[model samples]
Each structure stands twice: as structure tokens, then as C-alpha cells.
Target: MARQTPLNEAHRKLGARMVDFAGWDMPVQYSGIIDEHEAVRTAVGLFDVSHMGEVEFTGPGALETVNALISNDLARIADGQAVYAGLLDERGTFVDDVVAYRFSPERILICVNSSNREKDFAWMKAHAQGVAPVDRSDDYAQIAVQGPKAAGLVQRLTKTDVSKIGTYRFAEGEVAGVPSIISRTGYTGEDGFELYCAAKDAVALWDALLTEGQQDGVKPCGLGARDSLRTEMKYALYGNDIDDQHTALEAGLGWIVKLDKATFIGKEALVAQKAAGVKRKLVGFELTGNGIPRHGYAILKDGARVGEVTSGTKGPSVNKAIGIGYVPAELAAEGSTFDVDIRGRAVPAVVVKTPFYKKP
Candidate 1:
């Protein structure tokens, strides 16, 4: 059976079509994928992202524990800030990509993938050894309000001042009488806010936001649009763009790794890999002739297999087919030519800079 989010009823009330996704009954679309996708790029859209996992780190050694566990430096982030980072095994293989929220001097929250909640928590706990209190918080629900007008939409509904919050910053406040954590961040590369609130108040908060933004063209968005929007920005999707088999060094996420900081879980392995140089690297491409590039399609260089597509889609905003894939570092340069084997036919492709589609 698929788990339903607290806002499932609210989605249904708005005529959203629900589908089983990663063990959760999530909305695939409300009006249509393209419409919702464009609405977000132009106006605003709300997404029920309660399926994401939230892990809490507490105790005196919490900072030290995270510094040793993640590839990013947790000590540098100030309170009420967030950082995009990855958890790697001892061998430098990615365990999961996460966003760490520094809520206070002693409290840090790590948001992870829903499917890997148990495994990620267990891994962190086991690695803690005599570190901090790592508690898995599955009680909170999350929602993303995104697009160009997303900030205004959220500001209108909440009494708290959001004007001062900069990007990647968060504040604890109440929205529509529901206690919430409003973060100035989003996956869609838009000006938006992600609200973390109690599960019991999720439904009411969703309804209140929708009602407040009804006049401003705020539509109930779904996973389909969310995926499309993120793809436009070429944001790495965990299971697709990255995985346990791939190292952060090979995935173009080296910026998140703070090797200069204290010793980390995969520090030794990462240090060796960095010294040796990475082999295969993640790159972006655009379909030249036609046909959308789908995941797992073979990437050919000079009629020989080089790599494969990981994430692809025809971006609604750009009106062009774009994708991310792994290929040899030599062939990863921008403008390098390649071919995608789609249905046994070769389709022309070119290595393009990431963020295939950027919001104007």
C-alpha cells in the first residue's frame, strides 16, 4: 500500500490525480504538467513535498558529528542557514544527497529522500559511534511554494516578515495559524519558500495557502511539474542524476565537499580520488535533431558507447529537449558532439552547459 501525505485530501479536493511514487500516494498533476510547469516559471505553484525525510541532530557534539559525516563543512554555516551536501561511504561512494539546516547552535536538521529514510538514518547513527543524538523526525510535513511570485504569495499569507530572509535562509514562524519553518529555498531554481510544519496542521496550511493565492493564480502542483521544473535547472535528482554507485567527485558536486574542514566519513577516499583525478564526469546535453532523450539511453561518441543518459525531458520553458548524462571527462567538454541511441536509432546530441532551461 502506498502511504498518503497529510495533504492528500487537499490535493484530491483540487482534482489532482494521485499516483504511487516512492511508497507515497503523490499528485502527478492537477491541471496538466506543462501548464503547472509554466505557471511556476511565470507565477507560482504549491507542492506537497511531505514525502521527504527529516533527520534531526542534537546534543553537544552535533556539530562535530555532522562535520565528520558529510562532505560539506557544517561548522561554517550560521544558525538559520542551510547547505547542500552529500553523505558518502568510506569508499567515497554517495550514500545520499542532503540539505542540512542549521536551526540553532545545537540543532541541525538534515532533509533526505523518503525512500532512503531508514537506511540513511541507520547509516548516520552507526557512524556516530560516541557522537551526538541523531533522531529521525518523520513527524514533520513539508510543502514547497515556488515560482517568480512565490515569495509574495507566501508573504501575503503569513504575518511574519519574509522580506529580510535571504536565499538559503530559514525562519521559524506561523503561517495561517500553523507553526511552520519557512525556508527561502527551492528545487526549481526560483524565488520560493519551503515550509516545514507539523503533520497535523499540514492540511489546513495547504488549504489556507491555496485560498490566499487563488486570486494570484497559485495552482496545486504535482510531482510531474516538480520533476520538469527541476530538470530545467539540471538539479541533480538522487536516484537518477546521482546514486550510491557514483562518487560526488564524478557527479560535478565537488563544490559541496569541504576537504579543508575536519576529517569526514569519506575524506580519505575523496582525498585520494581528488589527487588521482576523476574519470567519468557528469555533463549536460541538448538533443540536436529531434526526439526527447530518456534515461538509460546509450550515449555514443564516434559511433562507440561512451556513457548513458541519466535524466532527460523536453523542457516546457525552453521548448527544447535537454538531459544530463555521464561521459568520459575528455568528451564532457561543452560543444563536444555525441549521439543518443534511442530505440536503436542514433539521435544527434551536443554537450551543452547545464541549466538547459533558465527562467527569464
Candidate 2:
């Protein structure tokens, strides 16, 4: 049997179409994918992201232990700040991508993808020298309220002065009378807050927000909208766009790797790869014709397969078929032309700058 979130009943009450995602019964959409996607783009949309995992690190060696495990330098950010990072295996490939929240020198929280929760916890535990990471996945429920009008809607329920929290920052407070860690983070390429509250308070919180934000056109969004939103931003989806076989540098995530920092897992391998130069790079592209690119579609250059699409969609926001794929580093340049073999037809495409959609 698949696990269910605290808001599972709430989703069902609201007529959500549930599907099994990573062993969790999650809503794939409420009203419709395009409607929910547009709601998050122009107004606001609420997402039940309780399926994600959270692990807390504490004790004297917490800071050092966390810093050594991930790619980014957590020390660069102050308390209440979060940094996006990648967890790598010994071979320099991604074990998972995570966001580390620095609460204090002795305390930190790492939020990980739902599907990698168990594997990631084991990896962190085995590599931990002195500090142990405790899985808090069931202890909390997360709700992501996103879009242009998200802040205003959230501000009405929380007394924390939500306007003051900048991107990547969080604060501990009560939202809709429920205690929560209101973090300014989201998977969608929009300004929003990911509110983390106790599991038992999830239904109440969801009810309060939807009831209050009704007039503001807040829609109950789901996984389908989430996927399209992230795709439009070229944000990587773990199983689709990144995995254990690809290094951060090759995935266009080199910016998060701090090679100068103290030795961490995969450090030596990354240094060697950097010196050897990256052979392939991930790039974004737009189809020139009517075809929609899909995952695993062959990317052809000179009528031969040189790469393949990892994520693709007819962007709801951009109104075009866009995709992210890996190709020879030499062919990763902007304006580079290629063909995607979609349904045995060669569909022309061009490599373009990423972030297919940017907030105005």
C-alpha cells in the first residue's frame, strides 16, 4: 500500500485526481493542469508537498558534518537562510539535490526529495563522522503557495510579516494559528513560501489558506502543475533530468560545487573531472516545429544520435515545446541546431538560454 499525506483526505474532498508518485498517493491535478499552472503563474496555487522529506542535524559537529556532505558552502549563509546543494556519491554523481536550512551553528535542516528520502538518509548516516541526521519526514507537512499574488494571500493568515522574508530565507511563526516554518522557497519559478507545519495541523492549515484565499483566485494545485512549472524554469527533476550517473558539473550545477572548500565526498573526483574538462553539458532547447519533445527522445546532430532529452513539455507559460538535454560540450552553445526524433519524425530545435519563463 502506498503512503498518504495528511492532506490526502482534503485533496479527495476537493475532487483531486490522485496517482501513485514515489509510493505516495498524491494529487496529479485538481481542476486541470493548464488551469492550475496558470493560477500559479498569474495568481496563486497551493500544493501539498508533504511527501518531501526533512532531516535535522544537531550536536556540536552538526555544522562541519553538513558542510562536508554537500557541495555548497553553508557557512556563507547566515541563520534563517537556505542554500540549494547537491549530495554526491564517491563517483561525483548526484545522490540527491537538497536545500540546507541553517538555523544556527549547532542546528540545521536538510529538505530532500520524497523519492530519495530513504536512500539519502542512509547515505548521510553512513558518511557522518560524528553527527547523525534524524529523519523527520513524518513529523512535518509542507505547503507551497506560489505565484505573483502568493505573498499577499499568505500575509493575511500569518502575523510574521511575510513581506520581510526575502528569497531563500525563513522564519518560525504561526500561520493561520498553526506554528510553521515559513520558508521563502518553491519549485515553481515564482515568488512564494513553503510553509512547514506539524502533520496534524496540515488539514487545518490547508483549509484556512484555501478559505481565506478564495477571493484571490487561489487554486488547489497538484503534481501535474508542479512538473510543468518547474520544467518552464528549466529546474531539474531528479529521476528525469538528474540522477546517480550524472555529475553536478555536467548537469550545469557547477555553481553549487565549492571545490576550494574542505574535502567532501566526491571532491577528488570533481576536481579531476574539472581538470579533465567536462565532455557533455546539459542545455535547454525549443522545438521549431509542431512536435512536442518527450523524455528519452534522441537528439540528433548531423543526422546521428549525439544526446537525448531528459525533460520536455509544451510550456504552458511560454506556449512552445521546450526541453532540457545533454549533448557534447561543443554542441551546447546557444543557437546550436539539432533534431529531436519524436515519433520517428525529425523535429528541428535550437539550443537556447535556460529559464524558459521568467517573472516580469
Candidate 3:
């Protein structure tokens, strides 16, 4: 049996189509994938993301200890700020991609993917020389309100001036009388807020938000829409777009890897790879011909396999078949042409500028 999130029963009550995802029974969709996807694109949508894991660290050495494990520079941001970073193995491959919220010099919270919860906690614990990390995943339930109208909807329930909270910043306040962490963050490539409240308060918070946001057309969303939204933005998925077999640099996440920061777990390997140059690189592409690309599809040049697709879908917002894949660096430029092996037939595709969909 899979584990259930605090909002599991609520999801069932809402008639969500449930499926097993990384040992958790999660909703894949409610109304429909396309309807839910467009709800987020045009108006607002609420998502029960309570399965994501949170690990907290506190004490005098928290900053140093955390900075050493992640590739992003924690020193760059002040309190109430968060940063997207990669937790890497010694070989420079991702253990997981995470968001580190800096509450203070002595306190930090890391939000990790549910699929990698246990692995991430164990990895952090093993390297904890000065500060120990506590798994707090079960203590909270996270709700994401996403889209252009998301802020206005969330603002109805919170006392905090959410309009003043810039991107990647957060504040702690009460929402419908329940204490919560209101963070200006989201997985969808849109303006949104992710609220973290006590697990026990999840139902109340969910009900309150739905009631308040009804006028804004906030619909309940599911994992299917989440995957499509992230893919449209070219955001890498852990087991698919990125894995231990592939380094962050090769996965097009080199921007998050701050090699200049004090020695990190993968610094040496990354330095060596940087010097040697990345052999293959991840690139975004759109199908020029008919056919939707899917994961594991072979990417070919002159009918010979050169790479494979990582994530692909019929982009709901762009209304095009798009995908991300690994190819030799020499062929990663925009407008570069390649062929995708779709069920034994070669379909044409072209590398294009990433973020298949951008909010205007």
C-alpha cells in the first residue's frame, strides 16, 4: 500500500482520479488534464502537493553545512529568501534538485521531490558534519495556488501583504486562522504561491481557499497538469530529464551550479568536466512534422541514434508537440535539425529556444 497525504481523502471527495506515484497515492487529474492545465494558464488552480518532503536544519553551523551540500550560493540571498539548487553526488550527478529556504543563519528548510525523499534525507544526514537535518515531511501539507490570478486569490485569505513578497521570497502568517508559510514560488511557469500549513489544518485550509477563490475560477489540479506545465517550461524532472547517470552541466542546469563557491561535494568533478567540456547537452525541440514525441524515443541524425528524449508532450499552452533531449554539444544550437524515431519512423524536429510557453 502506498502512503497517503493529509489531503488524500479530500482528493477522493473531489472525485480526483488517483494513481500511485513514488509510493504515494496522488491525484493525476480531476476535471481533465487539458481543462486543469488551461485553468492554471488562464486563471488559477489549486494543487495538493503535500507529498513533497521537507527537511529542516538549525543551529549555528546550518549555513556552512547546507552551503557545502548544495551547488547554489546561499550567501547571495538574505533571510525570507529561497534558491533553487542541485544536491549532487561526488561525481557531479544530481542526488536531487531542491529549493533551500533560508529563514536565518541558523535555520533552513529544504523542499525535495517526493520520489527522492528518503534518499535525500539519508544523503544529507551522512554528510552532516556540524548540523543535523531533521525530516519534517510529515509535519506539513503544501498547497500550490498557481496562475496569473493566483496572487489575488491567495491574498484573500492571508494578512501578509503578498503583493510585496517578491519572487522566491516567503513570509509566515495566518491563513483562515491557520498558521502557514506563504512562499512566492511554484512549479508551473507562472506567478503563484505555495502555502505550507500544519498537516492537521490541510482540510480547513483547502476548503477555505476553495470557498474564497471560487469567484476567481480556481479549480483543483493534479499531477498530470503539473508534469505538463513543468515540461513546457523545460524544467527538468529528476528520474527522467536528470538522473545520477547524468551531470547537472549536461542536463542544462549549469546555471544553478556555482563552481566559485567554497568547495562543495561535486566541485572537483564539475571542475574536471568543465575543463574537459561537456560532451552531450540537453536541448529543447519542437516537432516540425506530425507526431508527438515521448520519453526514451531515439534522437537521430542521418538515421543514426545520437541521443534520446527525456521529457516530451503535446504542450497544452503552446498547442505544439515539444520535447527535451540530450544531443552532442555541437548540435545543440537553436534551429539545429534532428529526427525523432517515433515507433520506427523518423519524424523531423528542430531545436528551439527553451520555455515553450511564456506568459505575456
Candidate 4:
């Protein structure tokens, strides 16, 4: 049986259509993906992300211990700030993508992908130099309230002065009578907060937000919309656009990899690759002809296979069929054209500027 989140009963009661994802029984959709997708783009949407893993490091060396495992430099950001980074192996390839939150030198938290929870913990344990990591996945439940109107809706329930919490920052306060950590972050390309509260309080927190956000047309979203939203923004999804086989440089995530920082996992490999230059790069493209591109579809150059689609979907917000794929660096330029093998037919595609949907 797939594991269930703390909000599993609440999800079913709200008429969510559940699906197994990353070994968890989670909601795939409620009022359909399109409606939920538009709700987030136009108004507000709530997502149960409790299945995501949270690991912590304590002791004065907490920051130093985790900093050596990830590619980003946490020393660059001040307290109350979080950074999106990659957990890389010695080969400079992704172990997983994660968000590291810095509370202080004595404590830090890492939110990891659900599928990589155990693997990430084990990796950190084996690589840890002094401090040890503790798995806190079951200790908390996370709810993401996102959209243009999302902040207002969340602010209504919390007295934490949400406005003062700028993007990528977080604070601890009471929300709807529940003690919570309100992080101004989200996977959807919108301004919002991801509230982390005691697992026992998830249903109440989820209910309070939905009850209060109804006026703003906040809909309960699920993984389908979540996938589409991230794909539309060209945000790489682990196990899809990124994996151990692909280096961070090839995946276009070099900005998060700071070579000047202290020696960390994968630094040597990345430095070497940077000097040598990456051969293949991930690129975004739009289908010029009919048919929606799907993952694993072959990307062809001059009718010969050259690459494969990593993630693709018919974007609901942009109202266009878009996809991301890996291709030779020579073919990654704007206006470069290729063919995507859809089933068996070849469909013409053209590389375009990424972020298929931008705030208007």
C-alpha cells in the first residue's frame, strides 16, 4: 500500500481524485487540472505537499555540514532565507534537487523530493563530516497557498506580517491558531507561502485556508496541475528533466553552482566540466505542427535522432504545446528547429525563449 499523508482523509472528503505518486497516495486532481491550473494563474490555489521530506541538522556545525553536501553556498544568504540547490554526487550529477532553509548556525532544514527522502537522508548521513541529519518528514505537514491573490488569503489567517517576509524568506508564527513556519516560497510561479505546521494540525490548517480563501476563488489543486505549472515555467522536475545521468551544467542550473565557494561534493567534476564546456544542453521548444510532445519522445535533427524530450505538456496558461529536451549545444540556440517523434510521426518544433508563460 502506498503511504498516506496527514491530510489524506481531508483530501478524499474534498472529492480529490487520488493517485499513487512517489510511493504515496496523493491527489492528482480535484475539479480537473485545467480549472485548478487557471485558479492558481488567476486567483489562488492550495496544495497538500506533506509528502515532501524534511531533514534537519542541528549543532553549531549544522550550516557547514550541509553546505558541503549541496552545490549552493548557504553562507551567501542571511538567516530566514532559503535557497534552491542541487544535492550532487561526486560525479557532479544530481542526487536530487532541494530547498535548504537556514534558521541559524545551530539549526538548518532541508526540504527534499518525496521520492528521494530515504536516499537523501542516507546520502547526507554517509557524507556528513561532523553534524548528523535527522529525518523530520513525519513531524510536519506542508500546505502551499499560491497565486496572485494567495498572499492576501494567507495573510488573513496569519498575524506574522506576511508582507515583511520577502520572497525566499520565512518566519515562525501562529496561523489560524496553529503554530507554523510560513515560508514565502512555492513551486508554482506565483507569490505565496508554504506553511509548515505540526502533522496533527494539517487538516485544520488546510480547512481554514480553503474556508477563508473561497472568496478569492482558491481551489484545491493536485499533482497534475503542479506538474503542468512547473513545466510551463521550464522548471526542471527531478527524475524528469534532471537525474544522476545529467550534470547540473547540462541541465542549465549552473547559476546555483558556485565554484568559488569552499570545496563541496561534485565541485571538482563541475569545475572540470566548466573548463571543458558542456556538450549537450537542455532547451525549451514549441510544437510548430499538430500533436503534443510527451516525455521520452525522440528529438530528431534532419530526420536523425539526436536527443529526447525530458518533459512536455500542452500548457493551459500559455495555451500552447511546449516541451523541454536535451540536445547538442550546437542545436540549443534560439530559432533552432528540430522534429519530435510523436508516436511514430515526426512533428516540427522550434526552440524559443523559456518560461512559456510570464506574468502579464
Candidate 5:
């Protein structure tokens, strides 16, 4: 049986086409993937992202415990701010990627992908013997408001001044009379806020936002549009872009690693790899012709398989087919050309700068 989010009924009322994703019944599209995608690019679109998992760590050793789990340093993430980092195995393979938010001196929240929730919790628990208590709050519900108009819509509904919150910062407040965590962050390459509220208040918050945003062209968006938007921004998807076999270096997340900070899991291996060299690097590209690159497609250079496509989609906003893939560092430069094996037919592609599309 697939788990349903608290806003499932609201999605149905909006005539969303729902599907099972990683054991959760989620809406894939409402009016259409392209429409919703464009709306988010130009105006604003709301997404039910309650399927994500949240774990809280707070105690005397909570900060110390969290610093040992991921590749990045938590001390750099300021109070009320969030930083993107990866949880790694001993071998430096990515266990999962997460957004760590520092709420206070002793309290912090880690948001992770849903499919790996249990595995992540178990891993943290086993390693957090001396750290603060790790508690799962999967019952909470979340919604993301994304795009240029996202801030405007949020300001109309929330009591706090949206401008007061800096990027990657969050505040505890109310939206439509419902207590919520309004974080100025989003998956798309746009200004937005992600709302976290109690499960029971999920539907009410969703309703209030939709009603308020209706005149501003706010539409109910789904996972399909969300995926495309993130792909356009070159934002990685967990299962697709980063997996257990890839490390932060290979996955293009070296910026988050803080080797100078106190040691953490996979620190030695990362240091070794960084000192020596990395085999491959993640890069962005666009299909040259009419074909659309898909995940798992073989990337060929000089007629030899050199890499694989991780995330690919037809970017509605950019009106092009774009994707992210891993290739040798030598072949990861901009304007580098390669062929993606799409259905056994080689499709020409060229590596371009990341964030294929950024709306101004």
C-alpha cells in the first residue's frame, strides 16, 4: 500500500494525476507537466513535498553528533540558515544528501529524501552514540512555493515579513492561521519558500495559498514539473544523480566538504581522493538534435562509453532537452561534445555550463 500525504485530498480536488513514487502516492501533474513547469518558471507554482523526511537533533552533544555524520561542516551554517550536504558511508559513497538547518545553538533539523528515510535514521542512530537524540518527525507536512512571484504570494499569506528572511534562512511563523516553518529555499533555480507545518494543517495551508495565489496565476504543481524544474537548474535528484557508488567529489558536491574542520565520516577517504585525484566529474549538457536524453543512457566519447546520464528531461521553460551526467574531468569542460546512446541510436550532445536555464 502506498502512503498518502496529508494534502492528497486537496490534490485530488485540484484534479491532479497522482502516481506511486517510492511507496508514496504523489501527484505527478495537475493541469499538465509543461503548464505547471512554465508557471513555476514565469509566475509561481505550489508543490506538496510532505513526502520528504525530517529528523531533529538537539541535546548537549547534538551539534557534535551531527558534525560527524556528513561530509560538510555544520558550524558554518549560521543560526536560522540551511546548508546542503551529503551523508556518506565509510567508503565515501553517498548514503544520502540532506539539507541541514541550524535553528539554534542546540537544535537543528535534517531534511532527507523519503526513500532513504529509514536507512538514514538507522545510520545516524548507530553513529550518534555520543551525540544528541535523533528523532524522526515524518508526520510533518511540507509545501514549496517556487518562482519569481513565489515571494509575493508567500508575503500575502504569512504574518512575518518575507523580506526579513534571508536566502537559505527560515522562521517559525503562521501562514493562514497555521503554524509553519517558512524557509527561503527551493529546488528550482528561483526565489521561493518551503513551508513546514503540522500534518493536520497541511490541507488548510494549501487551500489558503491556492486561493490567495489564484489571481497571480498560482497553480498546483506536481513531481513531474518539480523534476523538470530542478533538472533545468542542474539541481541533483538523489536516486538519479547521486547514488551509493558515487562520492561527493564525483557527484560535483566538493564545495560542501570541509576537510579543515574536525574529522567526520569518510573524511580520510575524501582527503585521500582529493589529494590524489578524482576519476570523473558531474557535468551538464543539452541534446544537439531532436532526441531527449534519459537516465542510464550511455555517454560515448570517441565511440567509447565514458559516462552515463543521471538526470534528463525536456526543459519546458528553456525549450530544450537538457541533462546531467558524469564524465572524465578532462571531458567535463564546457563545449565538450559527446554522444548519448538513446535507444541504441547515438544522439549528439554538447556539454554546456551548468544551470541550463536561469530566469531573470
Candidate 6:
């Protein structure tokens, strides 16, 4: 049996096509994948992301406790801000990628991927020095409103001044009479807010947003659109693009690692790897012709397999076939050419700058 979100019934009512994703029954598309994808690019779209997990740490040294576990420095950001980080094992490979939200020194929250919820809790519990983490996944339902007109549509219902919340920031407020944590963040590369409210309030919030946002052309989005949207932005998907086998540096997530910030879980290994240099890198590429690269497709160099595609798509927004994959650092430079074995037919491809589609 698959776990269902609070908005599962609502999604069915709205004619959503549901599919099993990470052990949850999630909507794959509402109108259509391309339609929902373009809706977010041109106007706005709503997503039910309730399956994501949340963990809270509250008590003295809670901030210090969490900071010691992840690869990013949370001390750099003030309260009400969130930082994307990696939870790594001693080998410097990812345990999971997470977003830490600092509310105060004693109370910080981490939003983790659903697939790693239990694993992360066990890992954190085993290594906790002081404050223990509490799983809050059941307590909240997350709804993402994204695109150019998202802010204005949401602002019409809430008096919290959503515009004041800059990117990577959040505030506790009432949106459509429902208490929520309005976080200025999104998986899709769009200007938007991820509204987190109580599980019981999910239906109300979802209905209100759709009713009010009708004027803004907000469509009910699903995982299919979400995957395509993130892929176009070159944002890594945990299971496909990143896993325990790949280190953060090799995954092109070096920006989140703060080496001088002192002893974190993977600091020693990351430092050693940094000194020795990453032998392979995850690189973004564009197909030269008509083939759409897919996950597990072999990446060939000089007619021999070098790596495999992790995330690939025919970008609806960019109208081009683009993909992300791992290759030797020497073959990762921009314009480096390779071949993707798509369904046993070698398709020529060229490495290019990431973020295949940039908003005009």
C-alpha cells in the first residue's frame, strides 16, 4: 500500500493522474505534463508536496547540533533563512540532501526527502551529541505556488507581505485564514513560495489557492511536471542524480560545503577529496540531434562507455533535448562531445553550460 497525502482526495477530484512515487501515491499530471510544465514557466502552478519529510530540533545547542551533521554552514544565515545542504556519511558521499531552516538558535527545522526520512532519522539519532531530532512529517502539508504571477496571487489572500520574504527566507503567517510557513523557495526554477501548513488544513489551502489563483492561470501540477521543471534547472534529483555512491564535490554541489567552518560529519573526507581532486564530475549536456536522453543511458567517449545519464529530458520550456550525467573531469569542460546510448543507438551529444533554460 502506498502512503497518501492529505490532498490525495482533492487531486482525484480535480482529475489528476496518480502514480506511485517514493512509496507515496502522488499525482503525475493534472491536465498534461507539458501543459503543467509550461503553465509554471508562463504563469503559475500548484504542487502537492506533502510527502516530503520534516525534522525539528529544539533545545539548547540545537543549532550547533545540526550544523555538525550537514555539509553547509547554517551559522552564516540569520534566523528565518534556509540553506540547502548535504548530509554526508564519513566517506563524503551523500546520505541525503536537505534544506535547513533556522528559526532560532534553539529551534531549527530540516526538510528532507521522503525516501530518506527513516534512514535520516536513524542516522541523526545515532550520531546526535546533544539535542535529539523529532520527525514532523505527519504534522505538515506543503504546497508550492510557482511562476511569475505567483506572488501577486498569494498576496491577495494573505496580509503577511509575502513580497518582503526574499529568496531562501520564510515567515510564519496566515494565508487564506490558514496558518502556514511561507517559505520563499521552490524545486522548480521559478519565483514562488512553498507554503507549509497543518495536515488538516491542506485541503482548504489547496482549494483556496486554486480558486483565488484562477485569474493567475494556476494549474494543478504533478510529479511529472516537477521532474521536468527541476531537470531544466539542472537541480539534482536525489535517487537519480545523487546517491550514497557520489560525493558532494563530484555532484557539483561544492558551493554548499564550508571546509573552514570546523568539524562536520564529512569534513575530513571532503577535505581529503578536495586536496586529491575529484576524478569525475556530473556534467550537463545537450543532444546534437533528435534523441531524448533517459536515465541509465550509457555515456560513451571514443565509442566506449565512460558514464551514464542520470537525469535527462526534452525540455518543454527550452524545446531541446538536454541531460545531466557523470564523466571524467577531463571530459567535463564546456563543448566536450560524447555519445549517449539511447535504446542501443548512439546519439551524439555535447557538454554545455547547465540550467538549459533561463527565464527571459
Lowest summed-lDDT stretch of 10 residues in model 5? 129-138
Question: Per-residue lDDT tens digits of candidate 2, residues 1-360?
Answer: 999999999999999999999999999999999999999999999999999999999988798899999999888899999999999988889999999999997998999999999999999999987789999999999999998888999899988998789999999999999999999999999999999999999999999999998988999999999999999999999998889988999999999899998878889999999999999999999999878999999999888999999999999999999999999999899999999999889999999988999776
Q: lDDT tens digits, residues 1-360, model 6?
A: 999999999999999999999899999999999999999999999999999999999999999999999999889999999999999999888999999999998999999998999999999998878899999999999999999989998899899998799999999999999999999999999999999999999999999999999999999999999999999999999988999999999999999999898779989998999999999999999999779999999999888999989999999999999999999998899999999999988999999997888988
| Per-model lDDT | 0.88, 0.94, 0.94, 0.95, 0.89, 0.94
lDDT of 3 by residue, 230-338 (tens): 9999999999999998998999899999999977899999999999999999999999999999999999999999999999999999999999999999889999999
C-alpha RMSD for every candidate: 1.2, 0.8, 0.8, 0.6, 1.2, 0.7
Q: What TM-score does candidate 6 get on C-alpha atoms?
A: 0.99
User: What lDDT score is found at residue 253 in candidate 2?
Assistant: 94
Residue-wise C-alpha lDDT for candidate 4, range 1-360, written one tens digit per residue:
999999999999999999999999999999999999999999999999999999999998999999999999999999999999999999999999999999997799999999999999999999998899999999989999999999899889988899999999999999999999999999889888899999999999999999999899999999999999999999999999999999999999999999998878999999999999999999999999999999999999988999999999999999999999999999999999999999999999999998888999
Tell me the number of clashing residue pairs for each predicted model: 0, 0, 0, 0, 0, 0
Clashing pairs in 2: none
Model 1 CA lDDT for position 206: 90
Residue clash pairs of candidate 3: none
TM-score of each: 0.97, 0.99, 0.99, 0.99, 0.97, 0.99
Model 3 whole-model lDDT (C-alpha atoms): 0.94
Query: Which numbered prediction scores highest in lDDT against the true structure?
Result: 4
Off by over 4 Å in 1: 131-136
Instruction: List where candidate 4 sits over 4 angstroms from the true fold.
Output: none
Tens-digit lDDT track of model 5 for 86-205: 888887778899898888757878998988888888888888757644655556899999988999999998779989999989999999999999999999888899999999999999
Kindly list the per-residue Cα lDDT of model 1 for residues 87-188, writing each as its tens digit. 889888788998899877567889988877878989988887445545455589999999888888888878889998889899999998999999998989
Model 5: lDDT to the true structure: 0.89
